[model samples]
Target: MSRKLPLLIAIVVILTGSVYYYFTFRRGSARTIQTFAYLRDPASRPELRMNAYTQCGTAPFIFPTDGLVGFIWDDSFRPGHRHQGIDIFAGTDVGVTPVIAAYPGYLTRQPDWKSTIIMRVPDDPLQAGRQIWVYYTHMADAQGNSFISQQFPAGTSEIYVEAGTFLGYQGNYSGDPNNPVGVHLHVSVLKDNGFGKFTNELEIENTYDPSPYFGLPLNARENTDTIPVCN
Candidate 1:
């Protein structure tokens, strides 16, 4: 009886550990795990790609770039860290995938910004009378060399760009050359400050879920398992 009890105890411990691992790692990072799988085989998902300036279903905004959406808005990397935007992995070498404007607006690239741009939408497409800002970043190499188009230079502001306008290419700039991110585009829909400028984009509260804009399930919390694709 004593030997049988010991075996039973060991089995219970093993089962408990397996459950803990699934809930802590697998379930918690299901989206991220699936993203890496898609990155390895982007061609497997075709519904996500369409002609530039074309929207999926009733989405107001067009697909900004062709790639597998790796991460999504509100995705948390750790405790108290919420991702502010959706990361579209190009699944190609840096500067190979082209990124375009999702909608028409006044584009601005700060003077010190090496791989970032912001577009001001006078009226939010989802909400009338409310202004929003479309922010794009990671358009640079690890060394901070810009990949943005020559048409919009540093300090360029208030330039009206049409939807599908060539903006730049994706890169792996993580601000630190030693720890460069994967080649991808991080885009967010930012809330406009009452002063007619964009609010802090790093904060989750200042960003909007891109689902309504792109008409896809771009929120990480909602979609897990597979890459987001239009039905």
Candidate 2:
């Protein structure tokens, strides 16, 4: 009976571990599972590619994270509401998820409304210097307000960043500080309106389809891809 007592205790320990695995690891959150799978093989990620090809142009923008993501570029979600930018959803979100600088450019922060970060990338790299703006927004804060100013209070002063610079974590601040658009990042590209100021992103018409903007695999399906983002 003494020998059997030790065996019984071992069995009980094993059973407890199995139960924990079943509840905690094996049956993890949906986002957690997706994130893991995405890191293992990114090209198989349909959630990130759902409307990436069909709707948001054939350009597959760089997968910004090893984390699982969902692309919401189609503004058709609501009538009369033209979403000018694309929203990328990350896994079981925490506040620290890094939003990478999509291109090598100068970054400036507008501490109004959504607290937008605009990157000015070179337009005519081969010729005389010309620049274009890539607008990114919804940087997260518990207050649902300006995280950019809190981090770098330099305001609109230009700060140069490379393609992989740590822009900030995913944000959701819209206009009201109390309400966020959710845990995600919104991005758009802008064209100069010829008056020395860029077109407003709110117009939808002013923004370019981000699909062809970043070095996305535009129209090239069947390629599992990866991109270098910030830590």
Candidate 3:
């Protein structure tokens, strides 16, 4: 038995490594299977596409863009990384899918920002006596060319825009031309700091779960196995 002990130990090590790899990497791939499939055939699901200025179910806010919601709020791609917003994949060529305002607010586009915009809502529709901000990004090309509408050019600030106003088209900008992300719109509901400005949106603590805002299952942890669709 002593001579066979080494082989047994080797087999155990191999099995253990396989299990670990399955859970670590393959599990993430399994989780995103639906997302990738939706990206390939987004037209298969019609309910997932909400038009601009239209509310899903009883949600007070309108859908900002039309596409399959491939990622939801609080989705984590890796350890210690939580996505702060929902990513709506347009399944079309860059700059072909239009993104619109989900709510009426004051829009601002910082001068140097190539792919971002923020809207300030003076009165939070969900919370009383508090302000909030709707943040959108990834609206530029891989080379940092803006796809935003020409009317709201760079340095736009405090311009009141009604719901359904054309904001821009989706792009695959990830701040690096060589490493562009998928063509999607990242929209987040940001909490306002005590001083009337939006807090850091990168932190999940500063962003709210968009489920209640859109009246759908938009929390990644809760809405697995399929892209979020309006019922």
What clash count goes with each model? 0, 5, 0
lDDT string for model 1 (1-231, tens) is 987999999999999988755544443276677677667787775665444556899888998987877778776666457789988887888999999999999999999999999999998989999999999999999999999999999999999999999999999998999999999999999998899999999999999989999988877667644567777
lDDT computed for candidate 1: 0.85
Q: Residue 18: error of model 1 in Å?
A: 15
**Model 1 error, position 103 (Å):** 0.6
All-Cα superposition RMSD per candidate: 5.6, 16.9, 4.6
Model 1 alpha-carbon drift over 4 Å, by segment: 1-28, 41-52
Model 2 clash number: 5
For each candidate in turn, the TM-score is: 0.85, 0.59, 0.85
lDDT of 2 by residue, 104-218 (tens): 7777776553456787765623224555677877775646545453444546657887666666677666666666565666777677676546678787778665545443422
What's the true lDDT of residue 215 in model 1?
88
Worst lDDT window (10 residues) for model 1?
A: 20-29
Write one digit per residue (lDDT tens) for candidate 3, span 1-231. Answer: 999999999999999988765444443354378668767887775665655566887887899887777778867677567789989888888899899999899999999989999999999888878899999999998998999999889999999999899999999999989999999999999999989889999999999999998888887667654567777
Q: Report the error of model 3 at residue 219, Å.
A: 1.0
